[model samples]
Target chain A: SQTIHQWPATLVQPVGSPLSLECTVEGTSNPNLYWYRQAAGRGLQLLFYSVGIGQISSEVPQNLSASRPQDRQFILSSKKLLLSDSGFYLCATSTGTGGGQTEAFFGQGTRLTVV
Target chain B: AQSVTQLDSQVPVFEEAPVELRCNYSSSVSVYLFWYVQYPNQGLQLLLKYLSGSTLVESINGFEAEFNKSQTSFHLRKPSVHISDTAEYFCAVSDDGGFKTIFGAGTRLFVKA
Candidate 1:
């Protein structure tokens, strides 16, 4: 079974502090990984997506960046945490074969609270 | 570019009542549609998807969605809902061969007793 594991399930960071959230996938190789930030009423915002090692795609200009150093490891980071950066962060993985991508499998998510 | 729009923001229904959540999408290329359910404080889970072939797809949990290409819509329906069904539902769309998947604003379904 494919599984996504994200760490720091909940975090309380002070403004201007640095941030790092890690996610790892098991039971699958070369899967597409994504980072999403969900704010109240705004739905899941696609922050970044990575299809392979050292490749990252930023969906929107924001205070965050993503990196895929390994095939199954994806990380979300920020140099400085802004108050507006507080939200639930989710990590998901999906496998694609010839035609299209499959449904995503998500981690428990990290709830970041920038104080 | 592709985008998704879930027509309803919230829907309140009693247990065992039928419900339909509307979704519409826009894409310049052939697309794939999906519905995901997120329980409170939990990550989202895939409920169903429409890739090709049949326009209608059903989940193991009795939820069904029909993809209407002409209307650019994929509406989810269930004959009856239970209290356990209360959750936020998101409609998503992605272009064929694209890695970026866009999600709708979401519809919160409140199944009351």
Candidate 2:
């Protein structure tokens, strides 16, 4: 059972400010970590995924970037935030097994408000 | 590439009544289908999934979804609904290797008393 811990349940930042959202996983090692953004009244959008440390793949290009500093630590960063960056960001992890992914466990998410 | 479509944006159902949330997908390769539930102000939770074998899958909380390969759909259903069932349901699809998973727009299930 993997548990995802995300910090700062809610954040209010000004435009052009830097942003960093951290996510750490417990109960699993070398898991596949992902960053997803859900805009209000929209679906989950895959932002980035990392298979291992220092290995990240971006799904969509935006003002955000992701990094896997450690096996269980995933970080989403933005050099300069924009108003459109304001949304609910989620950190999720899943174990790859039998050529398929097991259930994905999600964090409580961070509601980012860029003013 | 794979994409998922949740037909309804919101579904209003009465307590103790049957409810179904429709989902359809398009993919070039074999995929793993999943249904995730998101409560208000909370993250999404995996409800159930269909990888292989039986097309139908059941969740612990009395929710079930059938994987219809022919129709390319995975619709979630429950015989009787409760207020606790109110949440946003999302349909997801991933490749066989489970690399990238895409989620649908989400269907908000509102259970009325």
Candidate 3:
């Protein structure tokens, strides 16, 4: 069975502070990893997705960035957090088949609040 | 550009009542459609998907969606809904050849007792 782990489960940070959210997938190798943000009443917004290590595709221009250091490890980072950055962050993985038919599995998610 | 539109922002239903959430997509090429459910303050979970072969697909939780190629719609429905089924439902589409999945604004299913 494949599982995804994300942390810290909840976070409170001051504005203009640096932020790093980690996610890792187990029981799968070379899977497609993604970073998403969920705002209150808004739909899931794609932040970044990586098909392999050192390869990332950003869906929107924003204050956040993502990196794939390993096949199963993806990190979302921000140099300085903004008030708009506060939201529920999610890490997801899908089979690397590239057909878009495979289901995407999600982690429990991290609640980040910027004050 | 390929896009998905969830017709209703919220659907309120009494427990054990039937419900339907509409979705439509626009894509010039072949499309793969999916429905995902998100509990309050949680990540979205895959409810069902439509690739090929069968136009109708079902999930273990009694939710079903039928892919309508001609109409460019993939509407999710359930014969009866429970209070546990209250959640946000999202419709998404991926070009059969593309890796990125575009999501709709989402519909909130509020099941009342």
Candidate 4:
């Protein structure tokens, strides 16, 4: 059974501060990782996705960036957070090629509040 | 490119009543459809998915969705929804050969007692 873990379940930061959110998956290797943000009562917006280490794809241009430093470790970072960056950030992982289904498993999510 | 549309933003239904949430998608290529449920303050959970098998896919919680290829729709239906079923439901689509998953605006289901 694979599980995804995200740190700083809830975060409060002042405007223009740096942001770093970490996600790690246990029991799986070489999994595809993704970062998504959801506004209150709104749909999820894909920020970035990584196929492998040092490979990241940006979906929408925003103040955030994502990195896959390790096979099962993904990090979402921001040099200076904006007020619009306040939302629920989710980390998801899917097995590599030859895996059964393409369904993604998500972590508990980090709720960031920028004040 | 693929895009998903969830028709309803909010659906209010009495407990134990039947409910249906509509979803439509536009993709030039064959795509995999999925329905995910998000409880309050929780991450999204996979409810069901339609890949290449039967058109109808069911979850363990009595929710079923049928994929209509011609109509480009995958509508979620539940015979009797419980109060616990109150949550936000999202419809997502991904191309068969692509890794990007496009999600809809989502529909909030409120099952009142």
TM-score for each of the candidates: 0.97, 0.97, 0.96, 0.96
Q: In candidate 3 chain B, what residue range of length 10 has the lowest lDDT sum?
A: B94-103
Proportion of native contacts present in model 4:
0.34
**Please, what are the lDDT tens digits per residue for candidate 3 over residues A15-108?**
9999999999999888889998988767788899998999999999999999998999999999999999999999998763666646778999
What does DockQ come to for candidate 4? 0.49
Which residue pairs overlap in candidate 4's backbone?
A: none
Which ranges in model 1 have alpha carbons more than 4 Å from their true place?
A97-99
Q: 1 or 4, which is superior by TM-score?
A: 1
Sorting all predicted structures by DockQ, with the top scorer first, yields: 2, 3, 1, 4
Report the C-alpha lDDT of model 4 over A62-99, residue by residue, as the tens digit.
Answer: 89888888999999999999999999999998653532
Isolated chain A: TM-score per model? 0.96, 0.96, 0.97, 0.93
Chain B, candidate 4: TM-score: 0.98
Native-to-model Cα distance after best TM-score fit, residue A99 in candidate 1, in Å: 4.4
Docking quality tier of model 4: acceptable
Full-model lDDT, candidate 1: 0.93
Stretches > 4 Å off in candidate 4: A96-101
lDDT of 1 by residue, A1-115 (tens): 8988999999999999999999999999998999999999999999999888998989899899999999999999999999999999999987675345668889999999999
DockQ for all candidate structures vs. native:
0.62, 0.64, 0.63, 0.49
Question: What is candidate 2's lDDT per residue for B1-113, written digit by digit as tens?
Answer: 78899999999999999999999999878888999999988999999999889998999999999999899999999999999999999999887866778899999999999
